[model samples]
Target: MNPPTPSKPSPPSSSSYSSPQTLLALINNILSIVLLSSLTIKSFTGRWQVIHSKLTSLGSSLSSLSSSPHWSENPLLQSLLPSLLSTLQRLSSLSDCCSISSFSGGKLLMQSDLDMASNSLSHSLHDLDLLLRSGVLHQSNAIVLSHPGPCSSKDELSFFIRDLFTRLQIGGIECKTKALESLLQLLSDDEKSASLVAKEGNVGYLIHLLDFNNYGQNSIREHATAALSVLASANDESRKCVFEEGGLGPLLRILETGSMVLKERASAAVEAITADPENAWAVSAYGGVAVLIEACRSGSLVTQTHAVGAIRNVANVEDIKNSLAEEGAVPVLIQVLGSGATSSAQEKAASCLAILASSGEYFRALIVQQRGLQRLMHSMQEVSNSDTLEPVLRAISSLSKLDPSARLLSSSTTFIIQLGEFVKHGNVVLQQISASLLASLSISDGNKRAIGGCMGSLVKLMESPKPVGLQESAAEALVSLLTVRSNRKELVRDEKSVMRLVQMLDPKNEAVYSKKFPVMVVAATVGGGSSHGCRKRLLAAGAHHHLQRLAEMKVAGAHKALQRLSGNRIINTILGRTWRE
Candidate 1:
């Protein structure tokens, strides 16, 4: 068979050809050739020298890496070694051609190959540098040796986080992305991890990944943002760090152009960061106020809810409230209130409007002009949970501070009935807000009859050991209601109401409750020709003793109430005691 023409020895298979030891041996051989060979092409000498330097550096890194246990099985090494071997082989071939006396390829082609080879060498060296800097070699060795289980202690977990954080700092895109996924999972599961991240100052790396400009790394950006959201929600320090690292701008950009899911996450992050009122202006500085308003107008329900909350937080900064109003937040928030969104979203929207309205009459007028009052009333009518109802009531309370809003609210019997229910049975907070709302609406005589039904509830609030502000608001509401004669008769009929009013005037209760509103309420009770048996009720409740003490203290309205009581001769005869007029 012609001596079976001996087949040329087959080249080594790629798997064996690119083994870690083989690759390292090839790199060292190429380095020697590039350093020692005399090139015929004078112009190519400098480029070959550059390749020599890179190969020497890469050889040192590979040698150090090879000493790690099972280094050949390391994923990073497995992935990079084959490509690195291929580049080194190409460089070796180019070095040989340049060193030869008889080269066949065009000089330009040869030059082009040299440039490409140098570039390939540089790229390989960069990747190797990343590998060394990433600390993956050390991590891989630890994994192979001990085969560690789940982190059993905070120190172990912390070391793991620091390792992952180091990977985030220097690695290929895929390596960094994997690190981020692991980090996000850790943060979501462990509150302690979030705190650790903040304490270790790794928060800036997380914030740095918020760059939307990173092409093809949308998932990285999203996970980074989600991680930040977890950190912010869990730790206050993380929230402040997020702002300090200029994270708001990237977060807002995501809100503007990111996917719906991304927008939701970004909005949530913004919401958490801006929860600190001090960070409010950072949002405005990044022009995020307008983006948040636009989100309210069009984002998904979750996005809208977080956007509203972030806007509300920003609005807490007194200066940003006007900026929010000017950005047309009023109309969008009104729309959110009237939309079919979740009750939480509507509640936050209401709170945002309440904040804006609190800025001044200008925002209140804007709300009314935009029908926010009607929308809030509608929201109030639709929801029943205290969480939702409280903000709605507060929004109405704030908007109603305007005369027009008060008039509009006073005309709605449903609203008045709702206010009565809240004042009667709602929690102390709702009771206080409702009482304030009633005080605002009580400016109208027509509202007096409708609101007077809450007299018993308002009077009972005065006896609550809660904050004095509630009592003050309730007493103020009662004073307004007492302006009508029938309401005064109603108050006098409830001996408990008269007694609570008298108790409020005591010098002992002075520090606990303001004497001004209670005195006015008592004076209105016994003031006019309609005093009837009300004067006896006051004296019977010892209103004279407390009133006299208050008058001595020069409490406003105390002297007037004492004068009104002293003038009641029938009450004096009934008590069998005479007072000097």
Candidate 2:
């Protein structure tokens, strides 16, 4: 689609302000001229003479204002000047083509150049119309109509975007800028708009505008990059469009070379489009990781947030985790975690650490090397947001796998107590992570007593109907706590606790190994004759059948549990078996 070449009246106000009505009128005039030019170019008659005269007059007025002293001072007039000049240039081309056709007296315009200019003008005018009515402009207009999003409205929107893309292809900077703004507005959370824009081949337009290394205009580049991000963010198809159009290269360019604002915007887009693991790999291949790591190291909080988010997603690949740390992401992430970054930044930072930690002991040791555990634990105390806390807990859980780290964590009285409370009353995920941490920590002989003291909560967790993983974690912690004789004696004395342990052995639930281990641990404590009520509660809760079945399973823990139970005379009399048997 071609944009129209038509003269525009000079801005009425010397001041920077233009009322919404005047703005709308100016847009309408531009569209009207394009439409008229398209109709006039259909025939090579005197019609071109009338249109040329009107455009000539408009050109003179614009020239007069261009030399006026105050014209550059008014922002409104300043904006209008370029668009007016562009329109005049387009009109001048069309006028010359029309004169040739008229002199030859051809019934048809015969001049494809004139027809192409007129067609481009008509399309550009339509694009401007679409922008004006697109509801983005409505924010400035009081009596605005509602935005349309249904099927028909989307079709019309799709058509407008095609025209905008045409104008973009035709190389009018002013038209391209306006089209970028319109594209951004349409590409909201609306799926249809994104799909349409991608399907209509406008993704290339967005990528071209985002050519920050090539596009010298920072404002235009910023808008274009932002629009590209939005389009790519919508879904898989749109993201594929961006990647296929070679958007990743320019996005990385903006990240490395654009202004700070552009960097933040581009980083966010990188995060969105590279959401898929393969796409993330592509970004990493293109050396986006180093740029993002730099962003995390020195950029503003906003830039850090987006950069970290992108890193978090890209860190899905195991090799990338090492790459991130090798490039100095470990300390950067730890810094963001400790620096009191925004809740979102902290979440991403914590999550990135968690991903790295999940890769292996190397990353976990790295986190510990960076004082990551101390910082994470500290940040957990400062923030109450579940999202932030969840990742912190996950990283801590991963780190707890190392015996030295577990011992260190176990020694922190404050951290242990906080974790115990999380098991008791935190949300499901928090309960799960806390239980897992406590279970890991309980391996340290010194840590068992501290966890045993929180036996009441562990018992409650065993009885609660939570997700199977959480139940397993809680059960494991409970079993570890029972390894201490004092904890077993206290727990066995509580009939409810004994009954819960027996019920936990039912094996009907998932994670049967978790259930079996806890049962074996509890059974080991019971067989020692520490509590008189154990046999009665175990029989009362129908543990006999589950235990009998476990005994026949040939599992070592289950066998050991059965051997231990054999030593109880009351239990031996009931089952008619002994330890040696």
109 Cα displacement, candidate 2 (Å): 33
Steric collisions counted per model? 0, 5
Lowest lDDT 10-mer window, candidate 1? Answer: 1-10
lDDT of each: 0.75, 0.68
User: What is candidate 1's lDDT per residue for 1-581, written digit by digit as tens?
Assistant: 11222222222457566566776665566555544552333446776777667767876877777675545655555556666666766765566567545667797898888888778767777767765554555654423212124556876665567667655664578888887888777776676667677765367777778776764788888888888778777878767767787788888998999999899999998899888877778877788888999998899989999998898888878667878777788888888888888788887888777777777788888888988888888887788888888778777788877877777878887888788788888989899998887776745566677767789888888777686588788887887778888888888888777777777787887444567878878888877786766777778778888888888999998998988887756666765653433
Q: Give the number of the best model, judged by TM-score.
A: 1
RMSD of each: 6.2, 11.3
Highest-lDDT candidate: 1
Candidate 1, superposed: residue stretches over 4 Å from native: 1-13, 35-41, 44-60, 66-73, 93-123, 133-136, 139-151, 162-181, 197-225, 237-247, 284-287, 317-323, 442-446, 463-468, 510-513, 577-581
Which lDDT tens digits does candidate 2 get at residues 1-581?
A: 54444564453442543443354345446535544554546445555555455454444443444344433332333344445435545654454455333355453554454555555444444443433333232222212122445555755565556555644554456656666666677776466677778887557667877764545677788888887877778788888888888898889878888888888888878888778777788766788888989988888878888888989998887667768878898998999987857789999999988988888888888989889989988987898998999999999888888888887888887788788778767888898888877776745555566656567667667656557676667777776666676777777677776666776677674434455655655565655545445555555556666776766865447766655555567765755543234
TM-score of each: 0.82, 0.68
